[model samples]
Target: MSKFKKDGKKNTPAVSTASLPDIVFMLLFFFMVTTVMREVDLKIKLSQPDATEIEKLEDRSLVDYVYIGEPTNTALYGTLPKIQLDDAFATVEDIQDYVIEKRADRPEAVHGAIIVSLKVDEETKMGIVTDVKQELREVQALKISYSTREKVNKKKF
Candidate 1:
């Protein structure tokens, strides 16, 4: 027997993918944990005004939203500004009922901490905002927030 053929076991070349499934599972779990689904679908168009002072909301669960703007489908709601609670257009008189319903959803322990965000369009007059504010006050929903775009500061090089 030749020297090369003395021990005739050939070395097999193969790539090990044993860790691939673990990597894929880790990535899937990462995305699943980080992703947040959109809670509300906005039917109306909102152009929020820019503001110098802005504060980020820490807990999203305790906040409620009220949309104020001219309806996207202007033929239906006309050109006038209207308030939207959840999915439906609401009048100033409807605010009390809506506040009551939202307040009821929260636990009594944190009733004072519930925040109502007023998302109003930039072009919308303050009259509509004032009306909503007044209505909110009537229901004693004192914690209110004005949603606005953060003012960008340009650094002079």
Candidate 2:
């Protein structure tokens, strides 16, 4: 005689996944909101100079960026300080047209409020920068700022 009887039917457990979709969607939204998508892909390496005093831009929307550095893409561009406007490598002559197009993208009221920030490598010569400045001046886009890292002070014990 058997002490226990065998069950005719096995119980099928149901896993609850009703909230899985919500959790996945929440994670997706979180990443979407927190992530910052870079507008330009830099082909150069830039080491920003250190500064004793640095001022932060008040409004980011009213600012445009220009990058100058030695090209990291050695095969395409040689190892010299080159200008980058948005995603492409550009020349001094492109500055005026670039500024005009960028300025035109903004509202008319904010045209005067736009600031052009230059992120130039410390090793770069001033000649290229001077040319960029002249181009900006020609376009009447005189508001300019040099991007630099804040100096870190170390005290002797």
Give TM per candidate.
0.76, 0.75
Best by lDDT: 2
Which numbered prediction scores highest in TM-score against the true structure?
1
Angstrom error of the Cα, residue 80, model 2: value is 1.7
Candidate 1 overall Cα lDDT vs. reference?
A: 0.88
Query: Relative to the unseen true structure, what is the C-alpha lDDT of residue 54 in candidate 2, on a scale of 0 to 100?
Result: 83
Task: Report the lDDT tens digits of candidate 2 across residue range 39-124.
Answer: 58987798999987789999989999999999998778988789999989998889989999999999899999999999999999
Candidates' C-alpha lDDT: 0.88, 0.91
